[model samples]
Target: MPSLELDRYLGTWYQLAAVPQFFNLVCARDTMATYALDPQGNVSVRNRCTTWMGTPNEISGTATVNDRVTGAQLHVSFPGVPTQESLEGPTNYIVTALGDDYSWALVTDPSRLSGFVLSRTPALNEAQWQQIRTAIEAAGQSQCMYLTSPTTGGLSGIAPLCTV
Candidate 1:
């Protein structure tokens, strides 16, 4: 429910964990996303990950702000991919939680079927991780069961799974 400053939110973000998506099933490590404001005022999204086979995979998309008042909701669409009937609207993604410094963020869809824990770095401190977990639970999600920690080569301090 917190409003986000669009300018501060645009940058590279490493995916610490996520509710597994079919398209990202092959991702094994080094998952990341980058956001940039386009000339037309839309947000450009670029996501990349190291596949299980050690290959780098990537996808590009665009996001349109649906609510300027809150700056917390948007609709993201990837070209060449069929839009799901349920997500064919102005707002499909919402920033449910964001760090004070914009160093991290928790994003989810209207249905809460997909969730992502993103940060400026591949690793997060214990306190930050706890904060994200709490936010995930506050958003009506199962933090332990749903969030799957990625092996980004620096998560030794964090549990591989969200069980902790």
Candidate 2:
């Protein structure tokens, strides 16, 4: 499969849903991620969230587009963390589908090992949901887990359903 276009993929994007990371454990109200061009032209990330204590938490990181044409892989590092390490190895950001106006996007790893549904806004439409679902299936990641993002207008009452 081809990769996503890097330039078009850059910019601030709201996290619709993710696999749930340790850093976001205290997120209670809202969580957002912003991507911008860094000084070296790499991708800079700023992740913000409202903590359970009602305090704001923000982390800064940087990302490098692995493949220019495919924009499929990236290596992210948190400068604030010890040793400035990355959470994961070079992960693939396979572009599954994109919104007509580039308002939303569905991306997965090359192996379909992980996935995320991102949008310009916190919420997405039914059409967008279906599109993501289709993309997930197409990527052979139907067994992957789906997270509950209450801050993004998703259900928080129940646990996520893992197909695997």
> Which candidate number maximizes TM-score?
1
For model 1, give the 10-residue run with minimal summed lDDT.
152-161
Off by over 4 Å in 2: 1-3, 80-89, 92-96, 110-113, 152-164
Q: What TM-score, to 2 decimals, does candidate 1 have?
A: 0.89
RMSD of each: 2.6, 3.6
52-144: candidate 2 lDDT, tens digit per residue: 898999999887776667666676788657644764556545567787677887667666656666777777777777777676666676624
* Candidate 1 global CA lDDT score: 0.81
lDDT of 1 at 89: 64
**Given candidate 1, what's the lDDT at residue 94?**
94
